[model samples]
Target: MDLDQLRTFDRIVREQSFTKAAAYLNITQATASMRIRALEQLLGVTLFQRGRTVTLTDQGMTFLPFARRIIGTVQEGREALRRVERGRIAIASLRSLVSPLITEPLLRFQQHYPGVDVVVNEGRQAQIVAMLHERDVEMGILCWPNIDPLLVDLVPLVIMRERVPLVVAPEIAARLPARPSIEEVLALVPRVISLRWWQAEPETAAALVRLAKTSVELPTGPARRLAIKGEGLGFFVNSAVADDIEAGRLVEIAPPDFEALHRDTAMVVRSLAALDRDMLADFIAEIARECAKVGIILDNRLASLGDKVA
Candidate 1:
């Protein structure tokens, strides 16, 4: 019921092992177990199925978002007070979306507002959305199609569309048909390492599960790393791996009906009325400029890939 118990529970779920979670939180394993037991007794339902490897029960999955919100609330309050005192700005974003999207603009912002303090919190979209709803962050940069209106009324700015293509190492690409169908391509790839966020979509999630035998879920960075090694096929945004594609380290594989996937990237503020209007607008403008640059780079990369295909 207390913050400590909640923190322990969250860490345990993340680490998926009592011992590792305890180490992460700098507590003993017994203490971690005790906290989960206490929390379960208070909730009147078992949160996790205790076994060799910890797995969340149905109840745990239902409670996870609420638990995150509770922690986010406290952190947000502290951040609000910090902002009032020291002119701080907080941003929440997915781990993969941070680079090239927020990094350039953030660095520019720091140089422009040298007096203001910036705090960056990176997590999955769910966690980032919770932080935004709880007011833990002043602004957030996230990819589109994953936005939940129930979480927060997203006031999006600078919506940029970037192409995401299925890519593989040159050797793997060489083995694929000149222009394979979606089913053929899916069948040919020995493994499909999908990013978790992409799997969040209901249709994609179901399709991925259908290929569960050969698919593995990973975060963006690891998925790209594995793809570069030709370990498996990976679907990634052009901006993230344009250099690799251009340098021939990775090859874009276009299916007969590839559908040309594009994701919307946005810069959003918590609320138009709640924050400093001018400051938010200025930051949005800066972020938009950087996003434009990214779009240009992605377009160029895709064009190069097209030239190769032709």
Candidate 2:
């Protein structure tokens, strides 16, 4: 009948114990029992059957999904209220696109909304989305295509920069005495720096089909530095490595046409509709204005690809 009862049911189902649920909700065990009793009385059905081990009744089982959703919706609403009270919001991002997309908009958002503090939580896409869904962060900038349909709102941020040549040390290139090609550099080298493609679809291009020679799965931050140290050549997003290439720490050579390296990004919102938070609409408008620099161009070639996939 009330959000608290829904919360109690949801916690009881998840934790499988009244005591545990009470501890989680920061309420006493009796208060939890009373709430559930009130809920069962209002519903005119037994929710959970109590024994040494608790189990949901058939009616409770039927109600579980709705109960979880209601509790979750309530939790999301609370998070937005907390955000408004705190005058702060958090943003999440994938490691690769963190700097190029998240940093710039965040700085601009801070300048424009000086009273609101911005927190950027950078991690891989999965971790970022999990944080957003958990209400650990208010927003996430991550690749598009898959997000929790219920908990989050996804908006297209950018099309991303064009791919770049992945290279190894020019010195290594000279010493190898092999043809100066990204392929040769990769094949002949003892170890080519490996980007943690945890979410990356493996490049199945004929050239890239060969497994990495000596792979190291370092976190995104460290992977960049290790590549620069000449320990191994790393393949990275052009946006992440562009400045470094100019700095001469790593050479950008003709890298393979990696087959499955598609990266897209979006902003994740926890409860835009329920919380009456209309700011993301304004934020999306700003993104559209920025992406208009080179308006959407539809080429016959890409259209054909779409058709084939379609």
Candidate 3:
């Protein structure tokens, strides 16, 4: 019922673990459990099936959406109060997208709307969604998948997509007998991946695994280095590594049959009832236009998986 309870609940659902949620929210485990218990008692439904591994029950799944919105509402109410006195807008995104795609545009956006402070949240997809659910940010650029329906809308913004090369460190590449096939490279290379791309992109997903994800996780920045060092082949968004490719640091391992792969980009919006809402709408439109003017192709439906990676 209280904002604290709602936030605690949201974190619990995000992490799917009581202790992890407590650690995230900076509360004791007992306090986190107590809040969930209190919330369940208040609502008359067990939210989570408590055990060695916390799992959402049917009721827990049902309660999750409502809890997110309630927490979102509480945060929005506070922000609305702040906005009435001083303007602010927040955006969360993958760090990659924010680099060249958004940096200058944001500077220009701020110039026009000097009163509005743009707070940017950059991290993996789940973190972005968690921030959105907690009302920590008003807009988000995130890799796609498992986004909850409670979000007002997820605009398919297709910033860019390129084929992921199986890039081993050049030494690793040199170890190969000759050119390699995609399957052969995956089997041979030490894999690297961001939590986001590994989790979000279907093309990356298919390459790495299938069936609830055989889950080969990797560190964030190693793919590029791994390719240079020959540690492994990892996925890179094409735009991200063009310079490296031209510089010959990483080269796409070509398979005779290899042609295409896929990934998606999206913008998450706050639910409709939220405030500063109109400004956000305008900002989204302006960004779409600006991206187009720069040849980003705002109507980005399908981008080729060229000889690039990210």
Candidate 1: which stretches are off by over 4 Å?
1-77, 145-152, 182-188, 199-213, 274-280, 296-310
CA-lDDT, candidates in order: 0.72, 0.61, 0.63
Q: TM-score for all predictions?
A: 0.67, 0.62, 0.73
Q: Residue by residue across 150-241, what tens digits does model 3's lDDT show?
A: 45455453463434444445555665657666566656555544434635345644555442222345544555664677655555666566
1-310 in candidate 2: lDDT tens per residue? 9988887887787678999999988999999999999999998999998999888999999988888677667767887687768766656767666556545656666666777666767777666765665566755656555544434455333343335346665566556543354565666566655565434454542234355566666775677777776667656766677777788776765533443243444444544442233344444334434333322312112123232212
Arrange candidates by lDDT, highest first: which order? 1, 3, 2
Provide backbone clash counts, one per model.
Answer: 0, 1, 10
Predicted structure with the largest TM-score when compared to the true one: 3
Q: Kindly provide the TM-score of model 3 when superposed on the true structure, using C-alpha atoms.
A: 0.73
Order the candidate numbers by TM-score, best to worst: 3, 1, 2
Candidate 2 clashes between residue pairs 3 or more apart in a chain or in different chains: 143-264
Error of 3 at 81 (Å): 1.6
